[model samples]
Target: MSKILVTGANGQLGQCIKELSVSLDPDNTYLFKSSKDLDITNYQQVLAAFTLENFDFCINCAAYTNVDKAESDTQNAVNVNSTGAQNLATACNQTNTTLLHISTDFVFDGTKNSPYIETDKTAALSVYGNTKNVGETEIIKKAPKSYIIRTSWLYSEYGHNFMKTMIRFGSEKDSLSVINDQTGTPTYAKDLAEVLIKIIQNKPIPYGIYHYSNEGTATWFDFAKAIFEITKSTIQLHPIATEAYPLPAKRPKYSVLNSSKIKTALQLEIPAWRDSLKKAINALP
Candidate 1:
Protein backbone atom coordinates (compact mmCIF):
# COMPACT_ATOMS: atom_id res chain seq x y z
CA MET A 1 0.00 0.00 0.00
CA SER A 2 1.30 3.45 -0.91
CA LYS A 3 1.89 5.87 1.95
CA ILE A 4 0.56 9.32 0.99
CA LEU A 5 1.20 12.65 2.73
CA VAL A 6 -1.55 15.19 2.02
CA THR A 7 -0.71 18.78 2.93
CA GLY A 8 -3.42 21.37 3.74
CA ALA A 9 -5.59 18.77 5.35
CA ASN A 10 -8.20 21.25 6.59
CA GLY A 11 -8.77 22.77 3.14
CA GLN A 12 -11.71 21.75 0.97
CA LEU A 13 -9.77 19.57 -1.46
CA GLY A 14 -7.79 17.95 1.32
CA GLN A 15 -10.97 17.29 3.28
CA CYS A 16 -12.57 15.79 0.18
CA ILE A 17 -9.58 13.49 -0.21
CA LYS A 18 -9.84 12.51 3.45
CA GLU A 19 -13.58 11.86 3.07
CA LEU A 20 -13.03 9.72 0.00
CA SER A 21 -10.14 7.75 1.49
CA VAL A 22 -12.51 5.64 3.55
CA SER A 23 -14.24 3.99 0.57
CA LEU A 24 -12.05 4.97 -2.39
CA ASP A 25 -8.68 3.51 -1.45
CA PRO A 26 -8.98 1.87 1.93
CA ASP A 27 -5.70 -0.01 1.70
CA ASN A 28 -3.45 3.00 1.32
CA THR A 29 -2.01 4.86 4.30
CA TYR A 30 -2.64 8.62 4.52
CA LEU A 31 -1.14 11.32 6.74
CA PHE A 32 -3.09 14.58 6.69
CA LYS A 33 -1.21 17.70 7.82
CA SER A 34 -2.67 21.19 8.18
CA SER A 35 -0.68 24.43 7.76
CA LYS A 36 -0.16 24.60 11.50
CA ASP A 37 1.01 20.98 11.65
CA LEU A 38 3.44 21.54 8.78
CA ASP A 39 4.36 24.72 6.95
CA ILE A 40 5.54 24.11 3.38
CA THR A 41 7.27 27.51 3.23
CA ASN A 42 9.92 26.23 5.65
CA TYR A 43 12.51 24.18 3.73
CA GLN A 44 14.05 22.57 6.80
CA GLN A 45 10.65 21.64 8.20
CA VAL A 46 9.53 20.20 4.86
CA LEU A 47 12.80 18.31 4.41
CA ALA A 48 12.59 16.98 7.95
CA ALA A 49 9.14 15.51 7.32
CA PHE A 50 10.29 13.94 4.09
CA THR A 51 13.35 12.53 5.80
CA LEU A 52 11.25 11.10 8.63
CA GLU A 53 8.62 9.40 6.48
CA ASN A 54 9.19 7.23 3.42
CA PHE A 55 6.25 8.78 1.58
CA ASP A 56 5.33 7.27 -1.75
CA PHE A 57 3.51 10.46 -2.79
CA CYS A 58 3.12 14.02 -1.51
CA ILE A 59 -0.14 15.75 -2.46
CA ASN A 60 0.53 19.47 -1.93
CA CYS A 61 -2.86 21.19 -1.41
CA ALA A 62 -1.54 24.08 0.67
CA ALA A 63 -2.26 27.46 -1.00
CA TYR A 64 -3.30 31.05 -0.19
CA THR A 65 -6.56 31.24 -2.17
CA ASN A 66 -7.73 34.78 -1.40
CA VAL A 67 -7.48 36.47 -4.80
CA ASP A 68 -8.24 40.05 -3.76
CA LYS A 69 -6.30 39.86 -0.50
CA ALA A 70 -3.31 38.55 -2.41
CA GLU A 71 -2.89 41.89 -4.15
CA SER A 72 -2.09 43.68 -0.88
CA ASP A 73 -0.76 40.66 0.98
CA THR A 74 1.78 39.87 -1.74
CA GLN A 75 4.56 38.61 0.53
CA ASN A 76 2.34 36.12 2.34
CA ALA A 77 1.01 34.82 -0.96
CA VAL A 78 4.56 34.42 -2.28
CA ASN A 79 5.75 32.71 0.86
CA VAL A 80 2.92 30.15 0.75
CA ASN A 81 2.24 29.72 -2.95
CA SER A 82 5.73 30.23 -4.42
CA THR A 83 8.36 29.55 -1.77
CA GLY A 84 6.19 26.90 -0.12
CA ALA A 85 5.86 25.08 -3.41
CA GLN A 86 9.60 25.34 -3.99
CA ASN A 87 10.33 23.78 -0.62
CA LEU A 88 7.84 20.95 -1.19
CA ALA A 89 9.19 20.24 -4.67
CA THR A 90 12.78 20.25 -3.46
CA ALA A 91 12.01 18.00 -0.51
CA CYS A 92 9.96 15.66 -2.67
CA ASN A 93 12.84 15.49 -5.11
CA GLN A 94 15.35 14.61 -2.40
CA THR A 95 13.06 11.93 -0.95
CA ASN A 96 12.23 10.46 -4.36
CA THR A 97 8.51 10.96 -3.67
CA THR A 98 6.04 11.70 -6.44
CA LEU A 99 4.42 15.10 -6.04
CA LEU A 100 0.83 16.04 -6.92
CA HIS A 101 0.30 19.79 -6.69
CA ILE A 102 -3.00 21.64 -7.14
CA SER A 103 -3.03 24.85 -9.14
CA THR A 104 -5.54 27.40 -10.49
CA ASP A 105 -6.90 28.58 -13.85
CA PHE A 106 -6.03 32.15 -12.83
CA VAL A 107 -2.58 31.46 -14.33
CA PHE A 108 -4.11 32.59 -17.63
CA ASP A 109 -4.95 36.23 -18.35
CA GLY A 110 -8.33 35.16 -19.84
CA THR A 111 -7.47 36.60 -23.26
CA LYS A 112 -8.12 33.38 -25.18
CA ASN A 113 -11.73 32.51 -25.93
CA SER A 114 -10.98 28.84 -26.42
CA PRO A 115 -10.37 26.29 -23.68
CA TYR A 116 -6.84 26.57 -22.28
CA ILE A 117 -4.59 23.59 -22.93
CA GLU A 118 -1.72 22.65 -20.64
CA THR A 119 0.74 24.20 -23.14
CA ASP A 120 -0.93 27.64 -23.25
CA LYS A 121 1.19 30.62 -22.27
CA THR A 122 0.40 31.85 -18.73
CA ALA A 123 0.02 35.61 -18.47
CA ALA A 124 -1.25 36.06 -14.94
CA LEU A 125 -3.23 39.26 -14.33
CA SER A 126 -3.21 39.24 -10.52
CA VAL A 127 -0.77 38.65 -7.69
CA TYR A 128 -2.45 35.36 -6.75
CA GLY A 129 -2.16 34.08 -10.28
CA ASN A 130 1.44 35.16 -10.63
CA THR A 131 2.42 33.44 -7.41
CA LYS A 132 0.58 30.25 -8.36
CA ASN A 133 2.21 30.36 -11.79
CA VAL A 134 5.58 30.67 -10.09
CA GLY A 135 4.69 27.74 -7.87
CA GLU A 136 3.99 25.62 -10.94
CA THR A 137 7.30 26.63 -12.43
CA GLU A 138 9.16 25.77 -9.25
CA ILE A 139 7.51 22.34 -9.09
CA ILE A 140 8.49 21.62 -12.68
CA LYS A 141 12.05 22.77 -12.06
CA LYS A 142 12.54 20.88 -8.80
CA ALA A 143 10.47 17.71 -9.04
CA PRO A 144 10.78 15.40 -12.03
CA LYS A 145 8.09 13.00 -10.81
CA SER A 146 5.35 15.55 -10.33
CA TYR A 147 1.84 16.22 -11.64
CA ILE A 148 0.53 19.78 -11.51
CA ILE A 149 -3.24 19.76 -11.98
CA ARG A 150 -4.73 23.16 -12.76
CA THR A 151 -8.45 23.42 -11.96
CA SER A 152 -11.04 26.24 -11.94
CA TRP A 153 -14.15 27.30 -9.96
CA LEU A 154 -13.51 24.65 -7.30
CA TYR A 155 -16.28 24.27 -4.63
CA SER A 156 -17.86 21.57 -2.53
CA GLU A 157 -19.89 20.74 0.62
CA TYR A 158 -16.97 21.72 2.83
CA GLY A 159 -15.41 25.16 3.48
CA HIS A 160 -16.20 28.69 2.32
CA ASN A 161 -16.83 28.69 -1.44
CA PHE A 162 -18.98 30.25 -4.12
CA MET A 163 -21.69 27.64 -3.64
CA LYS A 164 -21.86 28.14 0.13
CA THR A 165 -21.79 31.91 -0.27
CA MET A 166 -24.69 31.83 -2.73
CA ILE A 167 -26.68 29.57 -0.44
CA ARG A 168 -26.19 31.93 2.51
CA PHE A 169 -26.95 35.05 0.48
CA GLY A 170 -30.01 33.52 -1.10
CA SER A 171 -31.35 32.82 2.36
CA GLU A 172 -30.54 36.27 3.76
CA LYS A 173 -31.43 38.48 0.79
CA ASP A 174 -34.12 38.60 -1.86
CA SER A 175 -31.91 39.61 -4.78
CA LEU A 176 -28.27 39.12 -5.70
CA SER A 177 -26.03 40.36 -8.50
CA VAL A 178 -23.43 38.12 -10.15
CA ILE A 179 -20.91 38.65 -12.93
CA ASN A 180 -21.92 37.35 -16.36
CA ASP A 181 -18.88 38.49 -18.30
CA GLN A 182 -16.39 36.14 -16.64
CA THR A 183 -16.75 32.58 -17.91
CA GLY A 184 -15.42 29.24 -16.65
CA THR A 185 -16.55 25.85 -15.37
CA PRO A 186 -17.69 24.96 -11.85
CA THR A 187 -15.73 21.97 -10.62
CA TYR A 188 -16.96 19.93 -7.67
CA ALA A 189 -14.05 19.29 -5.31
CA LYS A 190 -15.41 15.80 -4.72
CA ASP A 191 -15.10 15.00 -8.41
CA LEU A 192 -11.56 16.36 -8.36
CA ALA A 193 -10.86 14.25 -5.28
CA GLU A 194 -12.00 11.14 -7.10
CA VAL A 195 -9.81 11.95 -10.08
CA LEU A 196 -6.77 12.44 -7.85
CA ILE A 197 -7.36 9.12 -6.13
CA LYS A 198 -7.86 7.38 -9.48
CA ILE A 199 -4.61 8.83 -10.73
CA ILE A 200 -2.82 7.43 -7.69
CA GLN A 201 -4.41 4.01 -8.22
CA ASN A 202 -3.63 3.98 -11.92
CA LYS A 203 -0.13 2.58 -12.31
CA PRO A 204 2.40 4.17 -14.63
CA ILE A 205 0.83 7.58 -14.16
CA PRO A 206 1.92 10.35 -16.49
CA TYR A 207 4.04 12.97 -14.70
CA GLY A 208 3.35 16.53 -15.95
CA ILE A 209 0.87 19.39 -15.87
CA TYR A 210 -2.79 18.60 -16.59
CA HIS A 211 -6.16 20.40 -16.55
CA TYR A 212 -9.27 18.94 -14.85
CA SER A 213 -12.69 20.56 -14.39
CA ASN A 214 -16.33 19.72 -14.92
CA GLU A 215 -17.52 19.87 -18.50
CA GLY A 216 -19.41 22.87 -20.02
CA THR A 217 -18.70 26.58 -19.77
CA ALA A 218 -20.49 29.00 -17.42
CA THR A 219 -20.48 32.57 -16.20
CA TRP A 220 -20.75 33.47 -12.51
CA PHE A 221 -24.40 34.33 -13.08
CA ASP A 222 -25.02 30.94 -14.63
CA PHE A 223 -23.32 29.23 -11.69
CA ALA A 224 -25.41 31.16 -9.17
CA LYS A 225 -28.59 30.41 -11.07
CA ALA A 226 -27.77 26.70 -11.06
CA ILE A 227 -27.13 26.80 -7.31
CA PHE A 228 -30.48 28.52 -6.58
CA GLU A 229 -32.21 26.05 -8.87
CA ILE A 230 -30.72 23.02 -7.13
CA THR A 231 -31.39 24.39 -3.68
CA LYS A 232 -34.95 25.46 -4.65
CA SER A 233 -34.38 29.08 -3.69
CA THR A 234 -36.41 31.92 -5.18
CA ILE A 235 -33.68 34.54 -4.86
CA GLN A 236 -33.82 36.97 -7.77
CA LEU A 237 -30.38 36.88 -9.35
CA HIS A 238 -29.29 39.69 -11.65
CA PRO A 239 -26.51 39.19 -14.20
CA ILE A 240 -24.03 42.07 -14.10
CA ALA A 241 -20.88 42.99 -15.99
CA THR A 242 -17.41 42.71 -14.44
CA GLU A 243 -17.15 46.51 -14.49
CA ALA A 244 -20.32 46.79 -12.38
CA TYR A 245 -18.49 45.35 -9.38
CA PRO A 246 -14.94 46.44 -8.68
CA LEU A 247 -12.43 44.30 -6.80
CA PRO A 248 -8.76 44.51 -5.81
CA ALA A 249 -7.76 41.58 -8.09
CA LYS A 250 -8.59 41.29 -11.77
CA ARG A 251 -10.17 37.98 -12.80
CA PRO A 252 -9.82 36.14 -16.06
CA LYS A 253 -12.67 36.96 -18.45
CA TYR A 254 -12.54 33.39 -19.73
CA SER A 255 -10.64 30.50 -18.14
CA VAL A 256 -12.30 27.34 -19.43
CA LEU A 257 -9.81 24.48 -19.20
CA ASN A 258 -9.58 21.81 -21.93
CA SER A 259 -9.68 18.62 -19.86
CA SER A 260 -9.27 16.29 -22.86
CA LYS A 261 -5.60 15.66 -22.17
CA ILE A 262 -6.25 14.48 -18.62
CA LYS A 263 -9.24 12.46 -19.74
CA THR A 264 -7.20 10.76 -22.46
CA ALA A 265 -4.29 10.18 -20.09
CA LEU A 266 -6.43 8.66 -17.34
CA GLN A 267 -9.05 7.09 -19.63
CA LEU A 268 -11.75 8.74 -17.56
CA GLU A 269 -15.03 10.51 -18.30
CA ILE A 270 -15.72 13.79 -16.47
CA PRO A 271 -19.16 14.89 -15.33
CA ALA A 272 -20.93 18.00 -16.51
CA TRP A 273 -20.85 21.06 -14.26
CA ARG A 274 -24.56 21.02 -13.43
CA ASP A 275 -24.64 17.29 -12.78
CA SER A 276 -21.74 17.51 -10.36
CA LEU A 277 -23.27 20.62 -8.85
CA LYS A 278 -26.47 18.75 -8.08
CA LYS A 279 -24.46 16.00 -6.43
CA ALA A 280 -22.50 18.49 -4.39
CA ILE A 281 -25.61 20.39 -3.31
CA ASN A 282 -27.33 17.16 -2.36
CA ALA A 283 -24.28 16.07 -0.40
CA LEU A 284 -24.26 19.33 1.56
CA PRO A 285 -25.39 19.01 5.18
Candidate 2:
Protein backbone atom coordinates (compact mmCIF):
# COMPACT_ATOMS: atom_id res chain seq x y z
CA MET A 1 0.00 0.00 0.00
CA SER A 2 1.46 3.34 -1.07
CA LYS A 3 1.26 6.30 1.25
CA ILE A 4 0.12 9.37 -0.71
CA LEU A 5 0.29 13.06 0.21
CA VAL A 6 -2.27 15.49 -1.21
CA THR A 7 -1.69 19.25 -0.93
CA GLY A 8 -4.54 21.76 -1.18
CA ALA A 9 -6.92 19.24 0.36
CA ASN A 10 -9.72 21.75 0.90
CA GLY A 11 -10.00 22.79 -2.76
CA GLN A 12 -12.51 21.34 -5.24
CA LEU A 13 -10.27 18.69 -6.78
CA GLY A 14 -8.82 17.86 -3.38
CA GLN A 15 -12.29 17.38 -1.88
CA CYS A 16 -13.20 15.05 -4.74
CA ILE A 17 -10.09 13.03 -3.96
CA LYS A 18 -11.06 12.95 -0.28
CA GLU A 19 -14.56 11.72 -1.13
CA LEU A 20 -13.21 9.06 -3.50
CA SER A 21 -10.69 7.83 -0.96
CA VAL A 22 -13.43 6.48 1.32
CA SER A 23 -14.56 3.64 -0.96
CA LEU A 24 -12.25 3.65 -3.96
CA ASP A 25 -8.92 3.78 -2.11
CA PRO A 26 -9.11 1.55 0.92
CA ASP A 27 -5.68 -0.03 0.43
CA ASN A 28 -3.65 3.19 0.24
CA THR A 29 -2.94 5.67 3.03
CA TYR A 30 -3.60 9.36 2.22
CA LEU A 31 -2.52 12.55 4.00
CA PHE A 32 -4.53 15.61 2.98
CA LYS A 33 -2.99 19.04 3.79
CA SER A 34 -4.59 22.38 3.22
CA SER A 35 -2.53 25.57 2.64
CA LYS A 36 -3.09 26.65 6.24
CA ASP A 37 -1.72 23.34 7.44
CA LEU A 38 1.21 23.12 5.03
CA ASP A 39 2.11 26.10 2.89
CA ILE A 40 3.91 24.89 -0.24
CA THR A 41 5.88 28.16 -0.49
CA ASN A 42 7.73 27.30 2.70
CA TYR A 43 10.54 25.00 1.65
CA GLN A 44 11.35 23.93 5.22
CA GLN A 45 7.72 22.95 5.84
CA VAL A 46 7.55 20.99 2.59
CA LEU A 47 10.89 19.25 3.28
CA ALA A 48 9.91 18.37 6.86
CA ALA A 49 6.65 16.80 5.73
CA PHE A 50 8.49 14.59 3.24
CA THR A 51 11.10 13.66 5.84
CA LEU A 52 8.46 12.82 8.45
CA GLU A 53 6.42 10.63 6.16
CA ASN A 54 8.08 8.74 3.34
CA PHE A 55 5.37 9.36 0.77
CA ASP A 56 5.35 7.36 -2.44
CA PHE A 57 3.43 10.06 -4.35
CA CYS A 58 2.65 13.74 -3.82
CA ILE A 59 -0.37 15.11 -5.73
CA ASN A 60 -0.24 18.93 -5.84
CA CYS A 61 -3.64 20.61 -6.25
CA ALA A 62 -2.68 23.93 -4.68
CA ALA A 63 -2.77 27.00 -7.01
CA TYR A 64 -3.70 30.67 -7.29
CA THR A 65 -6.67 30.30 -9.65
CA ASN A 66 -8.16 33.82 -9.80
CA VAL A 67 -7.43 34.95 -13.33
CA ASP A 68 -8.26 38.63 -12.95
CA LYS A 69 -6.91 39.13 -9.47
CA ALA A 70 -3.63 37.62 -10.60
CA GLU A 71 -3.15 40.56 -12.96
CA SER A 72 -2.79 42.96 -10.02
CA ASP A 73 -1.55 40.54 -7.38
CA THR A 74 1.36 39.22 -9.40
CA GLN A 75 3.73 38.68 -6.47
CA ASN A 76 1.40 36.41 -4.49
CA ALA A 77 0.60 34.55 -7.67
CA VAL A 78 4.30 33.98 -8.32
CA ASN A 79 4.84 33.04 -4.66
CA VAL A 80 2.21 30.33 -4.78
CA ASN A 81 2.13 29.09 -8.36
CA SER A 82 5.85 29.34 -9.20
CA THR A 83 7.91 29.35 -6.00
CA GLY A 84 5.57 26.98 -4.19
CA ALA A 85 5.77 24.50 -7.03
CA GLN A 86 9.55 24.74 -6.97
CA ASN A 87 9.64 23.98 -3.24
CA LEU A 88 7.41 20.95 -3.64
CA ALA A 89 9.44 19.66 -6.57
CA THR A 90 12.69 20.06 -4.63
CA ALA A 91 11.29 18.23 -1.60
CA CYS A 92 9.77 15.48 -3.70
CA ASN A 93 13.09 14.98 -5.46
CA GLN A 94 14.97 14.84 -2.15
CA THR A 95 12.55 12.25 -0.78
CA ASN A 96 12.39 10.32 -4.05
CA THR A 97 8.60 10.76 -4.13
CA THR A 98 6.88 11.01 -7.46
CA LEU A 99 5.17 14.42 -7.97
CA LEU A 100 1.92 15.03 -9.81
CA HIS A 101 1.34 18.75 -10.40
CA ILE A 102 -1.85 20.37 -11.69
CA SER A 103 -1.64 23.07 -14.39
CA THR A 104 -4.06 25.13 -16.53
CA ASP A 105 -5.11 25.65 -20.15
CA PHE A 106 -4.21 29.34 -19.73
CA VAL A 107 -0.60 28.37 -20.44
CA PHE A 108 -1.46 28.86 -24.11
CA ASP A 109 -2.35 32.21 -25.70
CA GLY A 110 -5.30 30.62 -27.57
CA THR A 111 -4.20 31.61 -31.07
CA LYS A 112 -4.35 28.10 -32.54
CA ASN A 113 -7.59 27.03 -34.17
CA SER A 114 -6.94 23.32 -33.66
CA PRO A 115 -6.67 21.43 -30.39
CA TYR A 116 -3.45 21.90 -28.36
CA ILE A 117 -1.13 18.91 -28.09
CA GLU A 118 1.40 18.27 -25.27
CA THR A 119 4.32 19.59 -27.35
CA ASP A 120 2.67 22.88 -28.35
CA LYS A 121 4.81 25.96 -27.62
CA THR A 122 3.22 27.79 -24.68
CA ALA A 123 2.88 31.57 -24.88
CA ALA A 124 0.83 32.67 -21.87
CA LEU A 125 -1.15 35.92 -22.23
CA SER A 126 -2.08 36.56 -18.60
CA VAL A 127 -0.03 36.72 -15.40
CA TYR A 128 -1.82 33.70 -13.98
CA GLY A 129 -0.98 31.71 -17.06
CA ASN A 130 2.65 32.82 -17.02
CA THR A 131 3.03 31.86 -13.36
CA LYS A 132 1.53 28.42 -13.96
CA ASN A 133 3.77 27.99 -16.97
CA VAL A 134 6.79 28.83 -14.82
CA GLY A 135 5.60 26.34 -12.23
CA GLU A 136 5.47 23.61 -14.87
CA THR A 137 9.00 24.51 -15.96
CA GLU A 138 10.24 24.40 -12.36
CA ILE A 139 8.82 20.92 -11.75
CA ILE A 140 10.36 19.60 -14.95
CA LYS A 141 13.77 20.97 -13.97
CA LYS A 142 13.60 19.90 -10.30
CA ALA A 143 12.09 16.46 -10.47
CA PRO A 144 12.82 13.85 -13.13
CA LYS A 145 9.96 11.57 -12.08
CA SER A 146 7.09 14.05 -12.27
CA TYR A 147 3.77 14.37 -14.08
CA ILE A 148 2.30 17.74 -15.02
CA ILE A 149 -1.37 17.48 -16.00
CA ARG A 150 -2.96 20.54 -17.62
CA THR A 151 -6.78 20.68 -17.29
CA SER A 152 -9.38 23.29 -18.33
CA TRP A 153 -12.79 24.60 -17.24
CA LEU A 154 -12.71 22.57 -14.00
CA TYR A 155 -15.97 22.49 -11.99
CA SER A 156 -17.70 20.29 -9.44
CA GLU A 157 -20.28 20.15 -6.58
CA TYR A 158 -17.78 21.38 -4.00
CA GLY A 159 -16.38 24.78 -4.96
CA HIS A 160 -16.88 28.13 -6.71
CA ASN A 161 -16.97 27.55 -10.49
CA PHE A 162 -18.76 28.55 -13.67
CA MET A 163 -21.57 25.99 -13.23
CA LYS A 164 -22.42 27.13 -9.69
CA THR A 165 -22.17 30.80 -10.68
CA MET A 166 -24.54 30.27 -13.62
CA ILE A 167 -27.02 28.35 -11.46
CA ARG A 168 -27.12 31.17 -8.90
CA PHE A 169 -27.58 33.79 -11.63
CA GLY A 170 -30.26 31.75 -13.42
CA SER A 171 -32.35 31.49 -10.25
CA GLU A 172 -32.09 35.23 -9.55
CA LYS A 173 -32.50 36.61 -13.08
CA ASP A 174 -34.97 35.94 -15.87
CA SER A 175 -32.27 36.37 -18.57
CA LEU A 176 -28.49 35.91 -18.75
CA SER A 177 -25.67 36.57 -21.17
CA VAL A 178 -22.63 34.30 -21.53
CA ILE A 179 -19.51 34.36 -23.67
CA ASN A 180 -19.80 32.30 -26.86
CA ASP A 181 -16.41 33.07 -28.36
CA GLN A 182 -14.28 31.26 -25.76
CA THR A 183 -14.17 27.54 -26.52
CA GLY A 184 -13.01 24.81 -24.12
CA THR A 185 -14.35 21.70 -22.38
CA PRO A 186 -15.83 21.68 -18.87
CA THR A 187 -14.12 18.99 -16.78
CA TYR A 188 -15.73 17.48 -13.70
CA ALA A 189 -13.39 17.50 -10.71
CA LYS A 190 -14.65 14.06 -9.74
CA ASP A 191 -13.64 12.64 -13.11
CA LEU A 192 -10.19 14.17 -12.73
CA ALA A 193 -9.96 12.65 -9.25
CA GLU A 194 -10.73 9.21 -10.65
CA VAL A 195 -8.06 9.62 -13.34
CA LEU A 196 -5.45 10.61 -10.74
CA ILE A 197 -6.33 7.54 -8.70
CA LYS A 198 -6.05 5.37 -11.77
CA ILE A 199 -2.57 6.78 -12.44
CA ILE A 200 -1.55 5.96 -8.89
CA GLN A 201 -2.90 2.44 -9.12
CA ASN A 202 -1.16 1.86 -12.45
CA LYS A 203 2.34 2.42 -11.11
CA PRO A 204 5.38 3.08 -13.29
CA ILE A 205 3.31 5.11 -15.76
CA PRO A 206 5.02 7.50 -18.20
CA TYR A 207 6.17 10.75 -16.57
CA GLY A 208 5.71 14.00 -18.49
CA ILE A 209 3.23 16.76 -19.34
CA TYR A 210 -0.32 15.57 -20.22
CA HIS A 211 -3.72 17.10 -21.02
CA TYR A 212 -7.04 15.80 -19.61
CA SER A 213 -10.44 17.39 -20.08
CA ASN A 214 -13.88 16.06 -20.95
CA GLU A 215 -14.22 14.54 -24.41
CA GLY A 216 -16.13 17.28 -26.30
CA THR A 217 -15.81 21.05 -26.64
CA ALA A 218 -18.25 23.84 -25.77
CA THR A 219 -18.30 27.60 -25.40
CA TRP A 220 -19.26 29.25 -22.11
CA PHE A 221 -22.65 30.06 -23.60
CA ASP A 222 -23.13 26.43 -24.58
CA PHE A 223 -22.11 25.21 -21.12
CA ALA A 224 -24.45 27.65 -19.37
CA LYS A 225 -27.38 26.61 -21.52
CA ALA A 226 -26.72 22.94 -20.80
CA ILE A 227 -26.59 23.62 -17.06
CA PHE A 228 -29.97 25.39 -17.01
CA GLU A 229 -31.43 22.65 -19.21
CA ILE A 230 -30.20 19.88 -16.92
CA THR A 231 -31.48 21.67 -13.81
CA LYS A 232 -34.86 22.31 -15.46
CA SER A 233 -34.60 26.08 -15.30
CA THR A 234 -36.45 28.54 -17.58
CA ILE A 235 -33.90 31.34 -17.67
CA GLN A 236 -33.48 32.94 -21.08
CA LEU A 237 -29.88 32.69 -22.25
CA HIS A 238 -28.09 34.91 -24.78
CA PRO A 239 -24.79 34.10 -26.47
CA ILE A 240 -22.50 37.13 -26.55
CA ALA A 241 -19.01 37.63 -27.89
CA THR A 242 -16.08 37.97 -25.47
CA GLU A 243 -15.86 41.67 -26.35
CA ALA A 244 -19.41 42.23 -25.03
CA TYR A 245 -18.29 41.61 -21.46
CA PRO A 246 -15.03 43.29 -20.60
CA LEU A 247 -12.81 41.81 -17.88
CA PRO A 248 -9.35 42.55 -16.48
CA ALA A 249 -7.80 39.40 -17.92
CA LYS A 250 -7.74 38.36 -21.58
CA ARG A 251 -9.08 34.83 -22.20
CA PRO A 252 -8.16 32.49 -25.01
CA LYS A 253 -10.65 32.56 -27.87
CA TYR A 254 -10.15 28.81 -28.34
CA SER A 255 -8.24 26.65 -25.86
CA VAL A 256 -9.54 23.16 -26.50
CA LEU A 257 -7.04 20.44 -25.50
CA ASN A 258 -6.43 17.12 -27.25
CA SER A 259 -6.47 14.48 -24.48
CA SER A 260 -5.56 11.60 -26.80
CA LYS A 261 -2.08 11.16 -25.31
CA ILE A 262 -3.17 10.37 -21.76
CA LYS A 263 -6.11 8.34 -23.03
CA THR A 264 -3.84 6.23 -25.25
CA ALA A 265 -1.23 5.85 -22.53
CA LEU A 266 -3.65 4.72 -19.83
CA GLN A 267 -6.06 2.91 -22.16
CA LEU A 268 -8.87 4.88 -20.52
CA GLU A 269 -12.07 6.34 -21.93
CA ILE A 270 -13.01 9.89 -20.95
CA PRO A 271 -16.62 11.09 -20.52
CA ALA A 272 -18.25 13.82 -22.59
CA TRP A 273 -18.52 17.31 -21.07
CA ARG A 274 -22.33 17.30 -21.13
CA ASP A 275 -22.54 13.86 -19.52
CA SER A 276 -20.09 14.79 -16.76
CA LEU A 277 -21.99 18.05 -16.14
CA LYS A 278 -25.14 16.02 -15.54
CA LYS A 279 -23.34 13.81 -13.05
CA ALA A 280 -21.94 16.87 -11.24
CA ILE A 281 -25.35 18.55 -11.05
CA ASN A 282 -26.90 15.32 -9.70
CA ALA A 283 -24.18 15.01 -7.08
CA LEU A 284 -24.85 18.54 -5.80
CA PRO A 285 -26.91 18.73 -2.64
Predicted structure with the largest lDDT when compared to the true one: 1
> What global local distance difference test value does model 1 have?
0.96
Q: Tell me the RMSD of model 1 versus the true structure.
A: 0.6
Q: What RMSD value applies to candidate 2?
A: 0.7
Question: CA shift at 44, candidate 1, in angstroms?
Answer: 1.1
Clashing pairs in 2: none
Tens digits of per-residue lDDT for model 1 on 164-267?
Answer: 99999989999999999999999999999999998888976779999999999999999999999988999999999999999999999999999999999899
Deviating ranges (above 4 Å) for candidate 2: none
Cα misplacement distance, residue 59 of candidate 2 (Å): 0.4
TM-score of candidate 1 relative to the true fold: 0.99
RMSD list, candidates in order: 0.6, 0.7
TM-score of each: 0.99, 0.99
CA shift of 10, model 1, Å = 0.2
